[model samples]
Target: MIPVVQHQWKGNLAQAREIQVFLAQKVILKPFKIKPETVLAVDVSYSRFEKCGYGVAGLFKVAFDNRRHKFHIVSEQYYTNSDTVPFPYIPGYLSFREIPILLPILSQISERPDLLLVDGAGIAHPRHLGLAAHLGVIFDLPAIGCAKSRLIGDFLMPGLESGAYEYLRTNGKRIGVVLRTKPACRPLFISPGHRCTITDAWRLIFTFCDQYRLPEPLRRVDLMSKRMRKQIEKK
Candidate 1:
C-alpha cells in the first residue's frame, strides 16, 4: 500500500521543494525491470466557466505475452476539489490544490498500479521535477508524466506516430521525453516522475495508447472527472 503525505500550507509555494524531498525520502524507491502487468492513467479536468474542478484516476490492467497487449480498466475513482479555490493556476505549484482531493480517492483503490500515467509534465518542470515525479516519490510507484503540451523542455518534433521520441532536458538533466502516440496527432511530453526509468516511461505510454495522443486510461479518466464534476455542480 502506498501511504500519501500531502503538505498543507497557508497559500505558500516556497516549501514545495522541501516537502517534495521529504516525500521522496518517505517512500522506498525501487527499479522495476519492465514486466509490469498493469498500468493506470490519472488526470484532472475543470471548467473555468463553472469555477469547479475534479480528478479521475483508475487502474488499467494490461496483459502481455509475446504477441499483443490487452487492456481492462477497473476501479476508477473520481472526486471534487475543496469548493473554495486556494490559489490561481500557477505553472509549477498545481498539486497543492489538486492532489489534496485526488490523493484521498487514489489511496482507496484496491491494487496499487504498476505504473502511473499523469496528465501533466513530470520531471519537465522548472525545478527539473514536476507533479508526476512528486506523486511517484510520495507513493513509491513508477510513474510517467504525459503532458498534452510542452511545459518546459527542448526537443525536435518527434513526428506523428509511435517509436518517434526526442529527449527533453531541464536543469542540465535529460529529465523528459516527447513521444508521438498517433499519426498526425500532437506529440506528448513524457518524463519520469520517480523510480521509473525514462525508457520504461515511453513503453508504458505506447502500451496504453490506442489511436490517441493521450493514453486510453487517462483519456477515460479525464472524461470521467469532467462529467462527474458537472454532475456534482448540477446536483
Candidate 2:
C-alpha cells in the first residue's frame, strides 16, 4: 500500500494557501526516465443529494508492453464517500477540496503504479503546486498533471497538427507545455508534478496519447469517474 501522510483537510482559505505554499517547495523538478509497465490516473466525480455530496475517486491502470509498444487497461478501482465539502471552491486551492476524497482510493489500489497522472495542474499553478503536485509530494510518487485549460502562464496556441506544442513560460522560465494531442482540438496544459522533469512528462504523455486528445490512462479514469457518478445518481 502507498503510504499517505496524515494531514487535516479542514481549514480557512489562508490556511489552505499556506499549506500549498509549503508543499510547493517540496515539489522536485529533475529529469528521469519513465519507461513504465504500469501507469495510473485518478479523477473524482461529485453528486449532491440534499445537504451532502458523494465524491467517488476512479482509479484506472494501463500496462505497457515494451515489445509491442502498446498499452492496455489492466485494472480499475473506485472508492466512494459522502461528506459536505470542507473547503470552498476557491482558485489555487483545489487540492484541499479534492484530496480527501482521493486518498482512500489511492491507498486501496490493488497495485501501485509506476507513475500517477492527475486531471489538473502540477507546478503550473499559481503557487507551483496543484492537485498532481500535492499528491505526488505526499506520496513521493512520479506524477504529472495534464489539465484541459490554462490555469496560469502564458503560451502561444500550438499548431493544429497533432503532437505540436509550445512551452508555457512564466518570467522566461518554461514551466509547462501547451501540447496538441489531436488535430484541431484544444491543447492540454502539461506540467511536471514530482520526480520527473517537463520533458519526461511530455514524452510520457505523447506516448500514451495514441489516437485520442487526452492520454489513454487519464481519459479512462475521467470516463470512469463520470460513469460512476451517473450510476450512483440513478439509485
Candidate 3:
C-alpha cells in the first residue's frame, strides 16, 4: 500500500529530526473502536557486516473465536524486501533506516490492514515519532508500538501474571503501558502509534498474544525477517 503522506527518507541527522518533528504532529491518538479483522506486522533485521536490512511484513486475518473467546489468526501472508541500508544505526531515528525497505514489502500485500503492529516505539520516543508512529501516519492506519525494551519511560514492574500492566509515563504524562503478556517473562512496552488510544493498544495486543510475550503477528514477522537475514548470510 502506498503511503497517504509522502516524504523523502534519506537525510542527515538534523534533517531526519526535523522530519520526525513534523510527522509527529500528524500522529493522532484516539480510541479505535472497530475490531481489527486484519493486521499487518512488520519487523526489520539488519546485518551488521553487510550493512543490509531485511524487512518482512506479515498480514494476518484475525477473528475472535466464540468458543475460545479469544482472538486467533485465521490466515496469514508474508512479504519480504531487502536492500543495503543507506542510513547508519541511530538510537532514536530508526524509521529512516528501516522504512525504505519496509515500504516495498507493504506494497506487496494486497490486503488492507485494519491495524499495523510494529516492533518499536511510538509516542514513547523522545521525539514522539518512532518507527510505528511514522509508518502509521504515512499509511493513514491505526497502529500500535510493541517494543521489547523501554525507550524513554519509567514504570514500576508489573505483576508476574498474564495481562498485568503498569502505566509507562514520562514528564508525568502517560505515554504507554508496560505489560506482561505471559507469566515469568519480561514485559513489553506498548503504545498507540496512530489513530488509537492507549487502552486500545493494550487491549488489542493482550488479546492477540497467545503463549508468547510478543503478539502473534509481531512474533511471526520477527522470525520471518530473521530468517530472511539468515538466508542472505548463508549465500
Candidate 4:
C-alpha cells in the first residue's frame, strides 16, 4: 500500500530520534478498534549477514462472533520481499533499519487489512514511536504491536495463565501491557501503535493467538520470511 504520509528513511541515530519525536506526537491512543473483517500480520527475518533480510506479510479475512468471542480465519494472502539492510541495527530505533526492507512487501499485499499487527513495539519505545507506531502513522491505518521482548519500560511479570496481563508504565504513563498468550510460556508485550487503544491491542492479540504463544498470522509470516530469506540467499 502507498504510504499516506511519506518521510525519509536513511538517517543517523540522532536524526532517527528526531523523526521519532516528531512522529510520536501523531500517535493516537484513542480507542479506534473495529469489528475488523480482515487483519494483516507482518514480520522480517534476517539472514546470517545482518545487512540482508526478507520481509513477509500475511493478510487474512476473519469473522469474529462476540457471543463466542472467537475469530475464524476465512482466507489468507501472502506477500514477500528481500532487501539489503540500509542501516545498522540499533536498539530502540529498529524501524529505521528494517522498515525500508519491509515496505515493498507491505505495498504489494493483495488486500488492505482493517488492522495491522506488527511484530515489534508501538508506544513502548523510549521515543514512543516504535516500528508499529511509525508504520501506522505513515499508512494512516490502525495498527498494534505484539513484541516478543520488551524494548523499554519495566513491569511485574504477569500471572502464569493465558490472558493475564499487567500494565507497563514509563515515567508514570502507561505505554503498553505484558500479556500472557499461553500457559507456561513467556508473555508478549502488547502496545497501541496508532489509532488503537491499549486494551484493544491486548484483546485482539489474545484472539489472534488462538492456540500458540505467537498469533497465527505472525507465526505463519515469520516462517514464510525465514523460508524466503533462505531461498534468496541460496540464489
Q: Which lDDT tens digits does candidate 4 get at residues 104-189?
A: 87777656679999999998998899999999998888999999999998899999998899999998788999999999799999
- Candidate achieving the largest lDDT: 3
- Stretches off by above 4 angstroms in model 3 are 48-50
Q: How do the candidates rank by lDDT, highest first?
A: 3, 4, 2, 1
RMSD for each of the candidates: 3.0, 2.5, 1.2, 1.4
lDDT of 1 by residue, 1-235 (tens): 4555445656666676567555544433345576666676677666666355576676666665345563445444443342444456788777665666566667667687788778887777776567787777767788788888988977888866566888887655686788888887788888778777677777777777776667777888877777777787786
On the 0 to 100 scale, the lDDT of residue 129 in model 4 is 94
In model 4, the clashing pairs are 1-107
The segments of candidate 1 whose C-alpha lies over 4 angstroms from its true place after superposition are: 1-8, 21-31, 69-84
Global CA lDDT computed for model 2: 0.79
How many pairs of residues in model 1 come into backbone collision? 1
Cα RMSD for predicted model 1: 3.0
Error of 3 at 182 (Å): 0.7
lDDT against the true structure, each candidate: 0.70, 0.79, 0.91, 0.87
lDDT of 2 by residue, 101-152 (tens): 6766667776767788888998999999989999899988889999999899
